[model samples]
Target: MKSKFFIKGVISILLIFLSMYLIDVFVTIPNNVSIKVNEIKYSFKGKIIEKFAVRNTEPTHLKVLIKYDSIITISPNPDLVDVAAVGDSLYKPANENYIFLSSNGNIKKFFYTKLSYETRSNKNFPREWRNKWLDSSMWDSSKEIN
Candidate 1:
């Protein structure tokens, strides 16, 4: 009876460890990547000096080098990258989730929605995608981060 109980306890411990490892691999890592990318904030106005693609990443990102030597990585969506020129002026307001690009008096707004979608669809991403709950107005109440 004692040996049987000991074996049962060992099996339970192994099962618990396996479950934790699976959760960390499938749930934690993917959500962390999405959260980290969304946390990047921008508040500046400058002209784009150069543009290039960042390879080796799970999802290819476009690196936009702007005036004052500032670089920002954005999603490589054609609507955002194809329309932007080297000399275009880029404006991203403080505390906002989008940027405005102007070229030859034509202005276009590029939101981070594509970034969210790409990250969620990456091969390393999990089947269960997490929502951005913090963006809700309920989280922005005065009782919160005022």
Candidate 2:
């Protein structure tokens, strides 16, 4: 009887640890929201951006500028893309300022804005700029704002 009780206690401890680990893995940190805008349907590739988390407890702020031209069309709409608007925003642009939130709710992912502008230019921009814009810390992989 004594041995049985000890075994049961050990098993219970193991179960508790397992449960905690699972919770940590499944629980989302509520970092940031991501949205993707695709002009072509069913295309896996499209413009994306991640926005920082916006909650009563924590707020993320962003300011962006996009150069406009006769050939440009900002898709999705920056005004509509805000944590205040719908917790997250995503859109596709024919030609416009692309904005979105970062996944970690951090400002690092803001590089997407630079990327959009670089794409507009015929001249090749520095590789470092692209790297800076695409860096995971700078931007979220899951978020996409066209």
Candidate 3:
């Protein structure tokens, strides 16, 4: 009887983790956003999953969220590291160095992240870091905004 209860408990925990996994796999701020770079324009739709957020999506509206580590393996040229509009703020890439992004929400979620090439398992996430609440994309700089 005790073993039965133990198995049930383990299964419950696994299920919870699995649910979180599914949310990460199927959700992100719908592609209603993008970035424009002179001659290029990038866009992601506005997507929201009631209780979850992708690192590229809005975490504020999520209950179980997964963020990933984005490390800029190739430093964008300072000249190419242009400006972006994040909500009301204009974001600029580090241009010289790179930063890291982790699929976590504890404390790393609060730290500011730079525009780095998400690698390894962090692929397919938005290219830049911006709250998806603004209905915008971090990597939407493909067209001439100027």
**Top TM-score model:** 1
Q: Residue 139's C-alpha lDDT in candidate 1? A: 22
Query: CA lDDT, every prediction?
Result: 0.58, 0.34, 0.29
Per-residue lDDT tens digits for candidate 3, residues 11-123, read: 99999999988886677422312211210222111111233224475332221112223211222222221221111111222321221222222111121222322220143
Q: Which residue pairs does candidate 1 place in steric collision?
A: none
Assess the local accuracy of residue 119 in candidate 1 as a C-alpha lDDT between 0 and 100: 51
Writing each residue's lDDT as its tens digit, candidate 1 over 1-146 gives 99999999999999999999999877776635554344334466777666666675343344566666767765534456667777788776654556688889988876533334445445553343323323322322333221
Tens-digit lDDT track of model 2 for 9-59: 999999999998888566632221112212211111122333333456332
C-alpha RMSD by candidate, in order: 9.4, 14.3, 18.3
Between prediction 1 and prediction 3, which has the larger lDDT? 1
For every model shown, what is its TM-score relative to the native structure? 0.51, 0.28, 0.28
Better of 2 and 3 by lDDT: 2
Which candidate achieves the best lDDT against the true structure?
1
Runs of candidate 1 with Cα error greater than 4 angstroms are: 1-29, 33-40, 56-61, 65-67, 76-78, 115-146
